[model samples]
Target: MVTFAIGTDDFVVAGALPAISRDLAVSEGTTGQLVTVFSLAYAFSAPVMAVLTSRVPPRRLLGLGLTLFAALNFATALATSFEILLVLRIVTAVVAGTLSPAAFAIAGQRAEPGYAGRAIGVVAAGLTVSLAVGVPIGTWLSTRWGWHATFVAVGVFTVGALVTVAATLPRFEPVSEAGIGDRLRALRSPAILACAVTTTIGACAGLMPYIYVAPISEALTARPELLTVFIATIGVAGALGAAVGGHIADGWGPDRGMIATFGTALVVVLVWVGLHATVAPVPPVVIMGSLAVWGVAAWSNNAPMNARTLALAGPVGTEAMALNTSGLYVGMACGSAIGGLVLDRFGVTGTLLAAIGIGVCGVAAMVISVRRWPTGRPARGKAGKKARV
Candidate 1:
């Protein structure tokens, strides 16, 4: 529920941008900065906050973070000035950065033997579910009531998440009592660095085409309404993929799971490029089917990736997760920027080919990482001591 609320807060603003612009008397482009700042803040803050709060109990941190997050959303809904809202969004993002890594770390730590991947996947599914369900509902509320209503709704849901987390989550001590310097040093482990790099590269590859899905879809289909259906298909498939990916990691091991998921994603994207080349204006059903596969392959990789990072950075699991989160966001930003450049120079087809090339690099990075630390085992280092899952 916490992940769902945070994810909804992150993406829901896109749908409400026009209304927010009109109400706040700002350009839509300026209104869009809310999202850019949130992502940048989150990417930069996660690891730093994790280092600063390393000794805080997971349960306590989650509770406090969610409380602040809820309050921020409510305050954002009430803010009359865009400047205030932008600052509030940045603070809210910092809180979200704190909550998410702790949540994933706790889920992995508390899972029963051999079920860490499944547990993490369950938590990750919340984020995917938000993309599928929460954003749409929040968008509807914005259109029906007002843009501010969407923030109010997010706050309401976050309050529910806070209550559930406080009441149900077990109190766990910090995984490591290391000082900031020691925790930062743990991040230098080769295996940990490799995992982070793989995450960044894979995210960059997967998100490249995703950020430009609208234009890509337009080229494929004449009907505009089908774009909505295509997006819904991707979201639903992604949610399902999260669940299945966990089981794969547990049964096949994180290394194999990463390779399989990423390899499948590469193939799916290649198929998209091939279809576009061979058949201009491809059938809508074919596009939808391809998107479903792409979504599943792309989103399913999250679990094994998280599990891998946690295992490698055993003593500093939360810190590693935070770093992984940062890497994911960095890749997202880079992917969007690169995709825009490619789209401008080469069009949608060029964009797809560029994604494929980057994806190949991503897969190669994963392969090299797995070779270095086969079976997701941690490398020989202090950070790798007592590594789990």
Candidate 2:
């Protein structure tokens, strides 16, 4: 629930962007900056926070993070200006950054020997569901009551998440009592840095089309109603993909699993782009199916790759998890920003081609990591860190 609440808080903005722009006397582009700001804060702060409070108990940090997240959403509900809202969004993002890493780290530590993947998948699935349920619901509430009310609802959900987390999450001892300098040392590993790069690039490839989804739908086909359906399907596909990826990762080993996911996703993007010309003016079902396939492959890359990254950090598992999560958002922000620019300069097809190129680079990076570190062999244990499906 805490994980889903984190996802919900982030996704709520997508549905409310238009209203937020209008209410704050800002342009829609500026409204999008809200996402940019939050992503930036999340990316930079995630690992750093873990590194800073390396000695802090996971349960305490989780509780504080949840409370801060809910309060920030509450504050966002009361904002009267874009500046205020943007600042408060940053604050909320700081809390949001820890939610996923902590959840995954805890899940990894608690799962039975053979069930780590399933456990991590369950937590990640919550975030994916946020896109399906939270985004649309927030959009609905904003349309009906107002943007402020939408935020209030998210805040209320956070309250529930806080309660559940406090009750259910285990209070585990810190794995590393190292100070900031010590935790930061984990990034010094060349292999570790390579993992971050590939993960970021892969995420970039996946998100490129999403940032300008509206324009892409407009350019590819005449009927605009397919747009909403496509987005909704991607959200659902992503949730299922996350859940399934965990299972896949546990079986195939992390490196191989990521290779399959990233490689297939790259091909799918190219296939989708190639199909677009033929898909134009088609039945909605075909387009929906294509979008769903794209979501499934693209989103599936995270778990196996993430699990591999954490393994490199040794005892400082939280720090590594934080780094990967942060990189994920940073890549999303960069991809979305660049996609917007590419869309303006070259239109939808150009964006697709550019995204494919990024994916190719991601594939190359992952392959290079495999050769350098070869962390695909699973260790025999139910404790410490584990990879995705």
Instruction: Name model 1 segments beyond 4 Å from true.
Output: 13-36, 75-88, 141-149, 226-228, 276-283, 344-346, 376-389
- lDDT tens digits, residues 93-144, model 2? 8878867787777676565554566667777787778777776677678767
What TM-score, to 2 decimals, does candidate 2 have? 0.89
TM-score of each: 0.85, 0.89
Clashes of each: 0, 5
Q: Rate the local accuracy (lDDT) of all candidates.
A: 0.79, 0.75
Per-residue error for 351 in candidate 1, Å, reads 3.2
Off by over 4 Å in 2: 21-30, 177-181, 221-228, 379-389
**Best candidate (score: TM-score):** 2
Clashing pairs in 1: none
Give per-residue lDDT, candidate 1, residue 148: 89
The Cα error of candidate 2 at residue 124, in Å, is 1.1
Mind giving the per-residue lDDT tens digits that candidate 1 earns over 277-381?
Answer: 777588798888988898898788989999888777867888899989888867765666677667767777897888889889998999999888875432232
